[model samples]
Target: MPIQASFPSQEPLGLNADLIRKYNQPAPRYTSYPTALKFKPIEDKASRSAMLADIEDAEGPLSLYVHVPYCRSLCWFCGCAKIISTNTALADKYLDYLEMEVRRYANLIRSGRKVVQLHFGGGSPNFLSPAQIGRLDNILRSSFEFDPSAEISVELDPRTLSKSQVLAFRKLGVNRASIGVQDINSKVQEAIHRIQPTETNIKTISWLREAGINSINVDLIYGLPHQTESSFNQTLDEVLGYDPNRLAVFSYAHVPWSKPAQKILERSPLPTADSKIDILIQTVQRLTGSGYAHVGMDHFAKIDDPMVKAQEAKTLQRNFQGYSLHADVEICAFGMSAISQSKNSFRQNQKDLDAYYKMLDEGDIPLEKGYLLTPDDQIRREVIMRLMCDLELDFQARGESNGVDFQNYFSSELDRLQVFEEDGLISFVEGGLEVTPLGRLLIRNVASRFDAYLGDAKQGFSKAI
Candidate 1:
């Protein structure tokens, strides 16, 4: 089914400042329903082991995530789990432990379970040397049967990413590369402590394409301190000149409560919520008008990109990594703070590197927290993910399949949605619900209505805007 292309609409989201101010509140990005905030401490290693056991019997292909947590220096705006060190030797040591962790899981995963998707994400996967990248790739290939057409991808920091490293990655069969440009403005770069030159970014993209890594993605950020509309527009223009296959225009989620490094931003004049919303509006208009398809939720893709195809087909999926085209594969992640999701459970590796190493040295899974989805959690996840990805829900059909009454099962939640309905964010469509074009900008706000745990949590997450 071709994805309904009603979005990327020339029409505005109709989200005025007052409406945005009223609705802009802390909400989960819905990368996963019952977001990480709801995860409980894993009381026993056996629970994780049992999850591994299920993977052994599962018949589907796998998605492997390897987290590389080392960065040469800190990008103060970074919210990801990372360790900053100038020492290259640390990567070699980290790789040894990472290899051991992969081998440990390889023993549990069935031999024939082909890896269909492999992603290397981190503080910066580029932190590793060419030789180190080669070693990691070899270790993984030797341990698992990878599909010949597996989608192998890696995230890189363009500042330190070298052409030699890019070539090595290409030789290792990396078909996709995501580079962090963040912002090309000099002031924004200095403020964020990520001083990457525009020439470097253009060269990085050029090298990736020359290496035959055709699916290139460049990331741009809005709402950073020192970001003006003109500066951001210049950054966007510079990025567009590279003509990346995909663009991830993300809002700078300032959660100083969770990431103390972001506290530095408090000292600077960050954009107001109203201004941030304006930047978002500008982003949508620029990208969509430039012939890129808004793939929803901070992503834009060229018309022929697979992500656009997936969105059209309704097969697009969301995960901890943000958006993915591979929906059926179970993800098995290695390294500190990495999350592994299977059909029955979600598990995370220890967040502390020393603790993770200690646990793995003792021959344990190094898992710290996770959630085993209840039947109810699974059902709610379905509802949340659909509204999030497809922007529509067929309540009666979903209820029939899940063996629950559409309206009765969610009476209170539906009652809450009445406000949004009244506000024109959503409407009843074919006995179900659909997010209006005006509501697409506030999709997270719409999806949050289906969350069962939001009411009980007091922890502050990032704002929806």
Candidate 2:
């Protein structure tokens, strides 16, 4: 179909294959302004200490992320930095280092700052035994200050998850869970090298709810090898039947250059580009048509979900963990390959396990690369994040916030966006801009317009379809 540039912005998102192909180009995910691609090497240990000391006096509650970099097996589609291991001994050892790192931060971060959010992301947190899970939780609770009602969430690989582990997570104050359910089709699972049975996901979710941790989110990936429109719809059907509170249906990010394991999929007959976009369009129709709000860029949530509430109130935030409720808090991360975010800086821990363990072994911070946002970077960040999360921007009002003449400052960018406006992706209002429903799917492309570093250096990013 040809583009429909004249559609009313209030109309529900409509499929335009022309628009999909036109906007489907590589772009940074913008999980952070300037993105991780722009991060630079850290100078010294004092810079690390200074980062922590800086956090001591910062405003707002703290958000903590724990990275367990060991997975029982490699999932070909995974882009996360993870080690494939079954050694309980390795996790136990890693936990010791993780605790040391956490304690180091705890000592630096004053007790007055309460932790508002805690997340466990992984190779798979489910890879840990029940005791290890408890031990990791105890280390954090004993070291850091936590709000009683904080949202504690964990990412679980259903294939490795157990009822005991879920119970242990509940006991440790985990209230939310994200289970991987990429596809239920046998051929699709075999193609991706993540042979998860549908029953595994079903059983795991049931265990989480039985343990009273009811807020469950399931992740699905479209455009995988051997996947089809009908197969994916069936996968969606099964997942929706799981009755998840929120869902993230991501386009399979095929960055085989960085994650060499993904090369395995090249041997399989993958869906053609046209077929994939058809699946994407149908997915939006099925999800939104089923009453789930298209919660920006591949995420969907029920009408009453907290994420929907946050987006409606314009308090939703996009971070390394995807969309989050906390807006202004500093995110401090633990373990190797974890990235932490503060008001002005982004820092990632050492990605190599040996180096990561070495740093903590010597009582040093495991920082590898960091970036401090410049004033211009900050302004662009605000504009881009507003577009990505809030789905709109008030130029005159936001101009006052950034102390710039919005139209004059972004004049060039505005001129560049004429194509989007013409394509009906964005609409100009009286003194601001509103991203139309169709634009939300391509918000990364829309937001990348404000990125000062986005020109010709977008290496390792997935296409924006």
RMSD (Å) per prediction: 2.1, 3.6
| Cα lDDT over the full model 1 | 0.83
The TM-score leader among the candidates is 2
Q: Write down the lDDT of every candidate, Cα atoms only.
A: 0.83, 0.85
Tens digit per residue, CA lDDT, model 2, 398-454: 789899998899999998888989998889777777787788789899898888888
Could you estimate the TM-score for every candidate?
0.95, 0.95
Candidate 1 residue lDDT tens string, 1-465: 122445442455465556767777877888887788767787765776676676577668899999999999888889999999988789998889988888888888776789988999998898889999999998899899999999999999988989999999998899999999998888888888889998898889889988999999998889899887777888888888898999998888887888899998777789988888878777777887787877767888888888878776766778899888887678999999999887667888999999999988999777898877888988888788877777777777679868999799988888888888888888865577778755666788888878878874636678777
| Candidate 1 Cα misplacement greater than 4 A, ranges | 1-15, 456-458
Identify the runs in model 2 with alpha carbons over 4 angstroms from their true place. 1-11, 45-53
Q: Residue 295 CA error for candidate 2 (Å)? A: 1.0
